[model samples]
Target: MPKSVLLLWLEGHLQSWGYDSKFGVRETLPFPTKSGVIGLICCALGEKDPQDDFLKELASSTMEVKAYKNKFNDKTEQGLSLIMRDFQTIGTNYDESDPFKNLMIPKKSDGTKPVGSGAVLTYRYAIQNGKFAVFLEYEKDLAQAVYKALQKPRWDLYLGRKSYIPTEFIAQGIFNSKEEASQKLRQLAEIKKLTEDFSVVEGKNCDDCDVLLLNDVPVSFGRRKSYANRYVSIIKKED
Candidate 1:
């Protein structure tokens, strides 16, 4: 089957996509990750489960992404946004008198049960002037569904986190092949004079880019999440 691509504009002041976290410290990638983009699509289609068949199908497909600054550059693409960190406290200021509020407190995942309430301060990272043009080579049916859903999303859409809502609608159009879709992105970028910051490519070897073993593939989006592995080539422009 011919591949279909999805174009999205992920502009947010605060967007954190952390696949691996230790303790309360979370970090963000400069560009959108595969799992992150997939998560966004599933959210639009109201497919909450990571184990959803659609999720699996998408994980098995080929995908590519590029992050660009909204501001036009001098073609050097030297301008990449810096990641800003936010320190936040979870489970803060709940009235002890309210019994229901106590239940809302975060708990340890010891598999047995949680005792008492735990609140901790954590650090999150995000990029400024974040804009991305994604080219997902996925199944046609799934792509069509996603395009339609974005017009009237089944759930509220956000980039990575709930607070990181998109400033613009994501769906640009569905196209055949990566080049055709990417061509559209280039046109838009040309008009806006956007500069590419970095890009991620899947499956194939990107000799010009650095390779990474990312654990962002979704096997199950359920409560007990499961993940598969995907290779990403990080291509950055020299400053």
Candidate 2:
């Protein structure tokens, strides 16, 4: 069966696509991860259960991302979007007497207070003023359903973080082929005055691209989340 392409335009002031992160530090990749994209879709579909079967099919589907940045000018601060780190302190102060408030306090695995201060410091990284055009290849029926859901999402849609709401519509259009999706992206970029930074494509390594093994594939979601690795090719372009 011929595949259809669902084009998503991800643009926001602050968006974080967490690749490898710990409790102390949450790091973000330059582009959207597969898990992140899938999570957004699940939210749009209003699916609470873990979609393990859907993920299995998604793992084999082709997905491509083209990164874009605002054109450099005297008014703009930088030519490329930069990563911004946000520091937060949790469990600073809470009354133990109140049951609800006590849960907010930091505790050990055994529900005991720490010997030192109860405050926990965490650093979150996000891409500032980042834009991306994502093309996802899917079967015709699945693509149409996803396209409709994104158009009128059951749940609110955010870029990567809940606070980072999308400035534009997430569903751009559904195309019959990747070339058609690329055409739409070019038109949108021209209207937005954005310049291409790079492209990430899935598959074997090529001489002109950089190969990266990313563990962004979702095996299961919910409390105990896991992922598998996939090879991607990154091709950088000049201004």
Candidate 3:
């Protein structure tokens, strides 16, 4: 049977998937880690700490990603081409005396363990060329359900942090073929509702070339020494 897949274009001014970050000088993991992606799924499902079975199911699923290069002109320079830097994350200062800090602290299951000691930290980043893409494989029924849910997303989608809202809808419907996926994305672009600028292209490893092209918008979070997040959306050019 042909596997069902959901092609998501996750772009924001700043996107951070810090699986194991330290208190000061937080670091972003390469690619979305199991814990981070699953956490987001749990939020979308409107549940926290979901059942073990649910977590296992999601963790066991196959997820793949690829980075791309993005080139654009810097507004500061007169038509000077600028290479946008990949998104990254910075750690926030925490008060050790605060009780809540301990609970929210990045720790391992043994509880009281530091991240670098044994904890796993994973983050996802794509090249800046507005060409990065992620491919997710799921059970057919589940994929369809997810696609439907995206049509009318109920939750507020953000880059990595909630404060950084998406310029366009991140979640899109499932498609039968790569052609179909590209068509849907084109339709979205033609409508002129995207939050940032972007383009769509074929997937490199995709057999059918089923994938969405995304151009991320640069955004910063917090004050002083803020990190950048890239926001992206599905779009197409008008004929």
Highest lDDT against the true fold, candidate? 2
Tens-digit lDDT track of model 2 for 1-239: 77799999988889999988998899998899888998888788886566788777766677788988776562333534489999999887687899999888889989899887699988999998888889998989888888999998899898788999988888999999889998999999889878788888887658877888899998887778889999889887654
**RMSD after CA superposition, every candidate:** 3.6, 2.5, 11.6
Identify the leading candidate in terms of TM-score: 2
lDDT, candidate 2, residue 11? Answer: 85
lDDT by residue (tens digit), candidate 3, 41-148: 555655443255555555455454433233233211111112233333422355557988645556655776465433343343321212224556677887776655
lDDT of each: 0.75, 0.85, 0.45
- Model 3 TM-score relative to the real fold: 0.49
The C-alpha TM-scores of every prediction are 0.85, 0.90, 0.49
Those runs of model 1 whose alpha carbons end farther than 4 Å from true positions after fitting are: 70-78, 97-100, 104-119
Q: Write out the backbone clash pairs for model 2.
A: none
Full-model lDDT, candidate 3: 0.45
* Shift in Å, residue 59, candidate 3: 2.6
Residues 105-192, candidate 1, lDDT per residue (tens digit)? 6666763324544567888777666777777666788789888988888988888888888887688888876677778888888877
